[model samples]
Target: MSTQRKIVFDAIGSVTTEQYDDPHAALEPGQVRVAAKYIGICGSDLHVLAGGHPFAQPPTVPGHEICAEVTEVGPEVEGVEVGDHVVVDPIMACGHCRACLAGRYNLCEPPMVAGFRAPGFGRTSQVVPARNLHIAPRDLPWQVLAFAEPATCARHCVGRLPESARENVLVIGAGTIGLSVIQALRIMGAGQITSVDLDPTKRQLAATLGADRTFAPGELDPAETFTGVIDVVAAQATLTEACTRVVAGGTVVVMGVPSGPREIPLPSMQRFERDLVSSGMYVPSDFADAIAWLADGRFDAARLVTDVFSLEDAPKAYARAQEPDSIKVLISLSD
Candidate 1:
């Protein structure tokens, strides 16, 4: 039997690498065994490591943003084949759920998100449902393919904005998701995008990636308002600021996963007809669009990847990812 190496969050502030029997030997029908190429360290992964995630706790494997090469396909798998480079759509939904029935699996109740609610692709190899694999262009770098998940999320979040709110957009947070949001807005034809981040480096990167304006958190004018506001840093302060800074009839898209319960300006929202919407994980179409955008050069995938570490150095990668200067940190599992 082959062995696989995986990184696990043992507890708060603890990360460990362990070896396990490869599951590829028992791959079931409709499943594909993939050799992980690159796995991204997401904000949610950090939250889990800090014991702040609402749904995910420690003693779990953590890696959801994945780019892998298919090594083998099970009996019923057809579209995906060996030698294909694919991005894993980590959202696992039960087919019977109402949300899944409506093709809104991202909203499925108690959904099992790979690396959070379920085992993820943090290991050397993973057996995933073939349906979850999005065949990526062979020519795209694995680092670029690794961004499909975040880009899919950004696409979905931007799609949630009302047409009226798309004219003038303000994105809070210039991290991976925030930068992706800016790119998505531009590709979707939004006008006048502005970004806010605490890190000047991130702010500059935001401007480079299609944001018309970038500002440090404190530098933004309090009196200015935007037709749409996307809060990628869902902290209480950021949420309040986002709600207040949106135009009276505008929409605020909450894209960040809050660490804990937080309050919004409900009274103001009611008074002004301001819409508040939450973007959960993305749907299939969003993933497809993200891949298409990345393949067509609409999204600058390489720029988002700020750091890469070998799988053996995943703990260090996590620490580096937490640094303010790091945007997207990836663990390279294979060439």
Candidate 2:
């Protein structure tokens, strides 16, 4: 057996690379071993590293957004073969749960995310269930495939809004998810798309990605409103603006995960018949749509990727990801 390297968040302020005995000596049935080509650092991973993630804390392996190549296949695993490029859907759910039975497994009871609730894909090579792998176009760059996970999240968020509410959309927070939401909206044929972010660099990227307009924190007119509002920054101020700025009877989709409970004015929402909904991780269909979009050139994943670091520079990658101007930071495990 050989050794493999993996990154671990040993404590709130520490990130270290450690070696472990290769686990591919034997593969469990229905599992496949994949060599990670690229892994995207997600906001949730940073949250866990900062000791603010509600579920996952320090002493956890932090990686979920990944693009990998299959190296070995276990018994009973079909449809996936070695030498295939794939993206991973990290949601792990028990088939018996009501949410799973209804095909809404993203909301499974005791929701378990692979990188958080279970072992993650941060290692150079790891074994995952074959079912979670979605084959991607071999011709596409591995960096683009790394976006499959986050793009699925944007797909799910846009899917929550009705077609009528999509004509004019307002997206708050032009971060990775926000920029992704802009692209998803464009692919869905939205009428006019506007994005707001404090960072000028992100605002520029949002416009380049497909947002028809971009605004700073206070640049948008207070009286102007939209048919739909997507809050990618679930802070109290942004949430309040989303709820209040949406037109009556319109919808407000919350895509950002808050650190703690937030106060929403239910009475006003009820009085105005405004629907405030939220989107969780994503479903299999959403993941498929994200992959298809990336394959067909609908979603441009390359624009959002701003920084890349080698596996040994995991700490540097995480630090760059937190920078105000950096959009998406990736760790490359292979060529």
Per model, state how many residue pairs clash: 0, 0
Candidate 1 on 1-335: residue-level lDDT in tens? 78888889988988888888864577788888899999999988998999988788898889999999999889978888799999988988886788899999888879789988878778888888998889989998888889899999999999999888999999999888999999999999999999999887888889999999998877888799999999998999999999999999999999988867999889999999999999988999999999999999999989888899988888899999989788889999873
Error of 1 at 311 (Å): 1.2
For residue 194, model 1's alpha carbon misses the true position, in angstroms, by 1.1
Worst 10-residue lDDT window for candidate 1 reads: 19-28
lDDT of 2 by residue, 270-322 (tens): 99988999999999899899999999989998988899999899999998988
Model 1, C-alpha of 307: deviation from truth (Å) = 1.0
Candidate 1: count of backbone clashes, pairs at least 3 residues apart or interchain: 0
**lDDT agreement of model 1 with the native:** 0.90
Error of 1 at 162 (Å): 1.3
